[model samples]
Target: MAIRLRVLLALGCALLTAGCASGSEMTFRQDKRLTIVSPGTGKTVRLPVKVSWTMRDFTAVRAGSPVRAGTGYYAIFLDKYPMAPGKSLGSLVTNGDCAGVSGCPDAAYLAQHLNVFVTSGTSYTIDAVPSSGTLGSSSHYLTIILVDGAGRRIGDSSWTTSFTVAGAAS
Candidate 1:
């Protein structure tokens, strides 16, 4: 038993060392890029839904922090992508209503009004969603975008997936 434990420990150490040598905390697949891990496309899910995703070469930072290279938070859009003519969700909330003020829309406003949830983590749990237009279930789109600390989008780093909510009849 002791020898076996030592062997396991040694293997774990070697793997850790290899990962450190690679200089990346996580190993990502080239083709895998940014992808949703659960509640797959076309799958039906329940409320308090858990959504997870994975990305490459990026770090999730807390909102309102100073913008750092390769470090940002995620903006999750449920149903429709909040767009007002040429304005974005962040811009509209910041420059339009709030008038370019810092922390204008805030987190609560985003979730309650716009269905836009923000998080620094890799996963988010949706407590509730809109009712389905049809009977039984409804399809919704989940869009995840990497945004900077100031709530602006970072380049074109965005991913989208569709799923159904069971028992969300209208």
Candidate 2:
């Protein structure tokens, strides 16, 4: 009787532990894709253009919120590739204001530009305004990644698209 009771107790504990595991502990599906819908690749556009994209199979949530299974936020990468797994999106430069600023200022600027929380829907739009004084023509690359609550990138665009910024130059 004692041995049987111990076995039952151990089984109960194992089930409890499994149930307590957070969503972050589970493996996220990689079948989702992030696609840029606006300002198509190789196209020329004026300043203050609208950038849009679509994501599938992943639930979009507000940053800093409790992460749910299969739910996360988006991070925009401009002119750079997405960070590797386990890298924090906060380290990347996503806006022009980050220049000449150190520490919090830089982080604040990046936070504003890079991390985009989708309150609802799979499609999102953001404005891209040129900060460069002169912009006769410039090639800009954009990509996005889906990050879990822990700031780990779980999904990303396979390719970065290039678009030209015209009329921004003096």
Candidate 3:
């Protein structure tokens, strides 16, 4: 048991050292508040609704998804790290040079169709943690969608806004 513990400790230290030397491939972006869904469950109390949708890289946004002057780009979701070529959609932590995701849990969204109030307020702490390199400092199009636990669209209202990943010049 002691030997095993030492091996694990050494491995963890080695991984951290490697990451520091590799330089950060992520960054931190301001949280763009959005709407979501939540409910009081019997056991879990408040359950958070899952998010769904696709990311339309600004360069590929079609005319239908044109960027309006006043309206900003959409911030679909979090977790865009691709193990190979694709990406994951979830929240993460990071720091300088590290990529920052735009979406957030504790954010206010425009109440259009469904009541945004149903989404119990959450507090997302932006910390320097591991993240999939999905979002970065760039002008792109994002589409935010709300879904139920079973992966079903809840509201008719979705977001298509223009946004910029405020980061250092790359």
Please report the candidate that would top TM-score against the real structure.
Answer: 1
Clashes of each: 0, 3, 19
| Candidate 1 local distance difference test against the native | 0.76
Please list the residue runs of candidate 3 whose C-alpha ends up more than 4 Å from where it truly belongs after superposition.
Answer: 1-75, 78-137
Across 78-139, the per-residue lDDT of candidate 3 in tens digits comes to 32211111111122222222245343222232122112221211322222211222344333
lDDT of 2 by residue, 28-128 (tens): 56444667777798888776656677777777776565767788776666654678866665545445455665442332455355533222344444455
Which candidate leads the pack in lDDT? Answer: 1
TM-score of each: 0.70, 0.57, 0.22
List ranges where model 2 is wrong by over 4 Å: 1-32, 93-108, 111-137, 155-159
Error at 113, model 3, angstroms: 29
